[model samples]
Target: MSTPDIVLTRIDNRLVHGQVGVVWTSAIGANLLLVANDAAAKDELQQELMTATAETAGVGIRFWTLDKTISTIHKASARQHIFLVVKTPADVLTLVKGGVPITEVNVGNMHYSDGKEQISKKVYMDQADKDAINGLIDAGVKVYIKDVPEDKEQVLQKF
Candidate 1:
């Protein structure tokens, strides 16, 4: 198996949306959109939702669990262009540790959750989230906080 070039890896709470499915996908020119989330992988409804959204964007999508993602990393990397979407920073850390070779990550929209503090207009992070993101940074992954493809990339420094 060949290692696929993961062109872009984005952390968006809403994995597939107009901003991501259309804007980011088009900007990155990705042929494949992989949604690596444990919950979405096991839930048929979530898979269907992502599939439908990706279909609208005219891109291929696959919802895979962490383990599944690791196992299939080589195959995914073999592709020409791949845009990976995960729900959290923790997921990104896992992918990197699993030998995905993610050097940078776009922190899109984490949304306003219960304990998450608003770091930017479209981003929110709790302690654990912050730690995970920091971990990626410490591991040499350049983390950029940007909502859309047109926005300026901001480095997350709230940790």
Candidate 2:
């Protein structure tokens, strides 16, 4: 099968669960799912878990480390539709810092953490998270919050 068009979404929880596999994918018509996370890609257990979750989505899923993902997306020889997802603000930052070509970011689900303050009912941002997100904004990448397909998307600056 060929790679599909990528719909980039930034979800902080690290797992591409229900809202992602079913809701977002269906809405965006994603056929190839790319979940970029170092720990999960390197760990057999986590990979297995992610694989299991992906199997139910009726989409081709690939787990990639930051570097591999960046290269894949950057390659001129490679072209396929992809639903690109990264789990953290840091991952987004990493890609930007590495000069990965990105224009937009969509927040899906970022769970509550000790230092994380709720930016919205479905979103939260720690100071560093804010800075990282803002950095993406500074670099001209659009950042928005939408926990699921049906939720309203708010620009990160509004937070």
Candidate 3:
């Protein structure tokens, strides 16, 4: 049987970090990992950067860009059990605006930058960021914020 399409699409800046390697991977029972971002895609040298980081406990990785990701999702394919991930909520928002087929959005860890204010214990979402997230949710995307596997999954609406 062909595997399903993207099962989870998360918005976590630290894409292949601790949470991905340990919690999310097992919690979802997913094997394939795909990270889409411009810098990681265009840099070429940085290709497989996420792989080295994501291969902690034996996992496959594919890194794509915004344009590439959009194209791939549109053309259906029999993929392995893949959990697609993006770095920012804005990127997720952009995907929605581009009419991507992403339904579930998880906010893992959005670190605090200069202008970003801490919205929750594990989240640091700014107003514009909040607006983008809300737009996606309003457009019918199920957005959840959960830092680790053990932690409770809090819906982004609670923010």
Candidate 4:
């Protein structure tokens, strides 16, 4: 199996919005947007919405369950440049553990919720989120927080 060229892997709660569909996709030169989220995959409406957004951005999009993504990602065409996006750090960690060659992760937008601490202006995390990110770092993944391509990359240190 040959894996597609993964240009960028990002953790953004808002799966395929303007920043992701237009800015990050264009910046990374990814022809395909692979959204690996279990909930999004099962939600037909969300898939349709995200697909529309990706189409407007002129990029192909796929919403797959984490299991499917892990099993089938390597089967993608080698010519395909994939930009993998997921909702959380734990998802990223799952993909990595499942044999996705994700060396670096861009922490984009993790919204505030109960029990979640504000790690940065645009990021909030609870204990599990922090542990997942820390695990990624320990696995030699270069995890950084950057909302957009133009923003400065903030390397995440284990907390």
lDDT of each: 0.87, 0.75, 0.77, 0.94
Q: Compared with the true structure, what per-residue lDDT tens digits does model 4 show for residues 26-99? A: 99899999999999999999988888889988999999999999999999997789999999999999999999
TM-score of 3: 0.86
TM-score of each: 0.94, 0.87, 0.86, 0.98
- Local error of candidate 2 at residue 73 (angstroms): 2.1
**Ranked candidates, highest TM-score first:** 4, 1, 2, 3
Window of ten residues with lowest summed lDDT in model 1 = 71-80
The window of 10 residues in a row where model 4 has the poorest summed lDDT is 1-10
Query: What is the number of backbone collisions in each predicted candidate, taken in the order shown?
Result: 3, 8, 0, 0
Model 2 residue pairs with clashes: 3-80, 3-81, 4-80, 4-81, 4-82, 5-81, 5-82, 6-82
lDDT of 3: 0.77
What value does the lDDT take at residue 47 in candidate 4?
A: 89
lDDT of 2 by residue, 1-159 (tens): 223245665665766776677677778877777888887778887767666766787877888899987777655224445677888887988887876767788887787889889878866779888888888888898888877767777877722
Residue 47: error of model 1 in Å? 1.5
Give a tens-digit lDDT track for model 3, residues 1-159.
233477788888777776786578878877778788877776655555666666874667777788877767655456466778888888888878877778889888899988899877868978878888888888899898877778777877823
Give the higher-lDDT candidate: 1 or 3.
Answer: 1
TM-score of model 1 (CA atoms): 0.94
Residue pairs with colliding backbones in model 4 are: none
lDDT of 3 at 140: 92
Please, what are the lDDT tens digits per residue for candidate 1 over residues 49-93?
778778988998888898898888787545458899999999999
